[model samples]
Target chain A: MISNEFYSQENHGPYELYSLGDFELEDGGEIPDCKLAYNTFGELNKAKDNAIIIPTWFSGTSKDYEAYIGEDRALNPNKYFIIIINQIGNGLSSSPHNSPDLMSMSDFPNVRIGDDVRAQHQLITDKYGIKEIALVVGGSMGAQQTFEWAVRYPDMVKRAAPIAGTAKNTQHDFLFTETLIEAITSDPGWKSGNYQSNTEIAEGLKRHANIWAVMGLSTEFYKQEKWELFGVDTLDEFITGFLQPFFQMMDPNALLTMAWKWQRGDVSRNTNGNLEEALGRIKAKMFIMPIDEDMFFPPRDCEAEQKMIPGSELKVVHSIAGHFGLFGGEGSYYHDQIDKHLNELLAIPVPDKVI
Target chain B: MISNEFYSQENHGPYELYSLGDFELEDGGEIPDCKLAYNTFGELNKAKDNAIIIPTWFSGTSKDYEAYIGEDRALNPNKYFIIIINQIGNGLSSSPHNSPDLMSMSDFPNVRIGDDVRAQHQLITDKYGIKEIALVVGGSMGAQQTFEWAVRYPDMVKRAAPIAGTAKNTQHDFLFTETLIEAITSDPGWKSGNYQSNTEIAEGLKRHANIWAVMGLSTEFYKQEKWELFGVDTLDEFITGFLQPFFQMMDPNALLTMAWKWQRGDVSRNTNGNLEEALGRIKAKMFIMPIDEDMFFPPRDCEAEQKMIPGSELKVVHSIAGHFGLFGGEGSYYHDQIDKHLNELLAIPVPDKVI
Candidate 1:
């Protein structure tokens, strides 16, 4: 939803671009000298507890969720400090699109949610000297990172709002993610993840969008013929005509990387072979809300985890907007829910504030 | 699950190998000739009103749901005649696997839910000489067809049980269907659907199963490390380890064709442009139920459709099995709900049968 006008700018306020530094991926594989491009917003409070972490979704950049980080919104720059951490696949960060020494397809580390959270932890703790986060808020894959933060480092963050995210992967989601990655790597343009000049990953990217878009909206929207609003007469037209542009503009490698991470998503993996045990590890107070109509993180799946966590709050966003209901739809409807929940969490007085 | 001994039998009861004389598809495209490999059970009563229809799911043959159509089940031989129609692409029906002249990928005619229902109608009237069905039951893509029957040939069916299905295609679903097709088509072995040998298609089929196995199970299944139940550790091992053999037993062209049909699923496509208006055309009563943990058809989607359809009954099948819970699970606790509804429907006063 970021504007094209914003993308036209040279940089996003004093930001430092990173290279592929020596680091390990979530799958126990190592990618030496991985790169990362990122940006920061708001002044860091004295103790840094006021900092908010925003991780990007699939094909999202540090700039993707920039709209929510300015002076007015939830993570207002005027109050809490904000860090826009670019995910691995995002071109701005170390990605297949700009890597000087691109890894082979087989060598492209199979990253999990832990890898993403761990990397962001490195960025904040190593570089910014920030120790505690007031909150980690995100949507879709980003929300996955937010969840990982609570589980991977329970004491690192005070609260987490995981919206439109699943506690673990489903079979259908695995297939969808696999197909999307296969679409890219197997494409004639892919060249074994090393395509030559004059290749278009549009077919692969279009395929990704087709799958990912379903997770964004609800079945109710489809029944109502919302494709008309998007200006496509048929689903094929939506895939080939309307969606190709976005895909064509994306880096195929980054798409593959992000999809791989999404497919490998699981907090239980971090817990070492126990799902219920992993749920118990989340010491941070959690707000796990998934849209009731969401195909990706169906409320029933979320409810399973809700039942596991002793006192965790589980709210179902009742909207035809599906997964996107967390951000879109009536501002009153979404903001009220978000505000109510955030205020309640904020009211729980911390024994000591880092800020 | 059908027993291996049943599949081994050379004699498949009531299943005739019938080929269609030169026929055109719903899109006005000619198939030159087509074949329908189907099975029938029970007997058509004197009134012809005691007829039941069970349409096949995606990649499913006439034999897939055979256990459901028996003397003791809801579709008992003692009560009604049962016909298990195998949709096109199920190998028993016309597909690139057996067709002398194969349809190219670009030329593959778009087949909708209407097309499946219409073709099954022809089977009933032209082959069996039967007029009406007591019930049309199907799950997943099959469920899409069941609803199609209610909308397309409203007078022909008295009731429909569409499980884990929706009135229209959701974006999430479209992506899954499209990506699966793409996964097969993108394979270097695929050769753009013009492979001289079916080896690549076999690879595509294997990949297709990999996707299916993931989508069918709950994340909890994976989180619990139940791949051991399926006898595997990692997903890749699970994919290459087991699904390859299961998928190898099927025809590749049939898989692609079914995937194509699933993407084009729309009841409204036959009734008119409006989906709700199409629902209004349904003369047959509907019992729409989705698995409580089904990722593809979340319960909220079912609730929304139930609200739209007057007098339609919506029930949630509580099981951890996800999409497959409709036909799977331990004892199927939801079977009681289904049995109760069917018993009530059968007791209702009947009017003159419609031709």
Candidate 2:
């Protein structure tokens, strides 16, 4: 078995774990002693009503959310009690990399965005005694969880901000994720998700990175030579130094697990396959923000979803960085836009408590 | 060794080989006893002035070009003598699969668009005594060759039609190709281009097909479920029956070789990296066509190149099929547009020879 250090707070954190014993999955499979890794910033106010939840994206840990949170950022640590939870299958959580043998790798139960939101609900309510969430803010797969939180438990989430993601995974997005998963599992060294170490599947990981190079960012990102902003001179250097190394440290099975969940991310599942009906269920004050250049989740797709959610507002974040713009790379211009919109979202007055 | 039947006319034919002993590549590498696979439709006229040349696209053979050649097609056998030449890396020609042991697989020297056009030029002049091509037409990598033929030997190619491709591969397109090549190479069974039989690299090929599913076709294609037109009901069936089987027959190294050539396609290389100067050298009446939904070679990219080519006309073929529309699929609506354009191009009277 791989050492727990791979998922330990010591190596990749400023985080803590909330253990939920023998958790049953949405697909009817169960994990023995399920745990979720999460980190919190700022302090809960006297009424404990200022708490906001930020879920991690695919392959992201709680630490990956740190860049988006700061004193004066969109996710201001000072103004809001921020709980950034690592989604299951992100290695740091109860993922294929750390789960019991029966529920590891290829055998890991199929997880859904709703399941992650349910776990987040358990963590927030049981651990912190927080009945209402001030907001749920995230981008990409993180945004998927935000949508799920609003639609699945509308009363619990008072406000929600989903950036660079849709209420449901579009067919195009599902196909994109499928290609990414195939890039990893097709590696001979993958050994059908039974590889001894990540090094054995290095080529697969590298190929996975290459896929991101094409789809994770906009075409204009390369045309504009934006890799120079990341301190890389050539495409090869960008791939070698940034893309490859980033995925190499990751567990392929964990990525597959997250990808499977990402592919099935549809709030409509809760409303018996009615997308508009599901969006209608969200009573949260919704802010749907999509990046203009994000090919995976275009602004048009987000705008369509915003129309379905009652009283939801649409904010299109313009950036040539594509989906990666949400990460606040290259001087944080996009981050500022996100911050500006999020502040606007936070400014919306809370409604009176209903019986 | 894989059987030569894989490259023979019996399986994919009506094509014949033209031998060129000890052919030297533009890169200074030599292929001993080089031979090119080609198919000629219709006999050369007494004037030898009605001859047109068509170069095969990536992974395509002369046989694959058969669909676009018929009695009433854009390339009419009755009116024009069409010689469809397979590009070098395509298995039907001299490829990694059938090359001599010393220059096989990973050892196959890099081939370029200019190199393929040069070989096609030699075949036309040496074999058929055809000095002037009435038209040089192709799509994708074949279009790259058409651009090469027009610029590299302007006097020889009277007119050129490059569809769904560019004079130079865009950074976005290059990144897309890199992911494809990486997808195949990362396969454990690839064994660094030394894999035995196509079956060993099945997963890699499937992954490669998956990438095509995302980028080779437009989002609208999936949104409308156009795969139904291809006789496949589900995405899995579309992948297995059409995508996977299509690429599995070709050699991985050949695909890699073609991808490398596709990435480096630049007419500017002929004019010391001055794009405008190289495009200026194209004395051929140019008809630059690009697919409207082709992510790899969008119409805007084609329009930019068209402006550079002196007096070049831009014809955008509108299709939700994306790049695959160039293949004349789904009742060949796109092909009819190409045919109409080519008819207009052919109607332009040839000028009298200047003394």
Best by DockQ: 2
Model 1 lDDT tens row, B1-355? 1112222225334467666666667877766566667777778877778888888887677776765655656767787887888787665665655555455433455565676677788778897777777888888888889888888887887888887887776666776676567667767777656565555467667667766665666665554544554556776676677667766665555677788788778777865668888888887777887787676677777777666665678867676657766554334365665566666666655457764
Q: Which digits, one per residue and each the tens of the lDDT, describe model 1 over residues A1-355?
A: 1112222236433456655468787567676776666677788988767888888777667665665554545667788888878887665666555545456433466677787788888888887788888888777788788878887887777877777776666655666677567656656676766654313555666656665555566656665655654556885675567666666666676678788788877778877858788778776677887777675677777778777765688876666667656545445566666656665665565446434
**RMSD vs true structure, all candidates:** 5.3, 2.7
Best-performing candidate as measured by TM-score: 2
- Steric collisions counted per model: 16, 1
Residue-level lDDT tens digits of model 2 in B233-272? 8877877888888887668888998999999999999989
lDDT of 1: 0.68
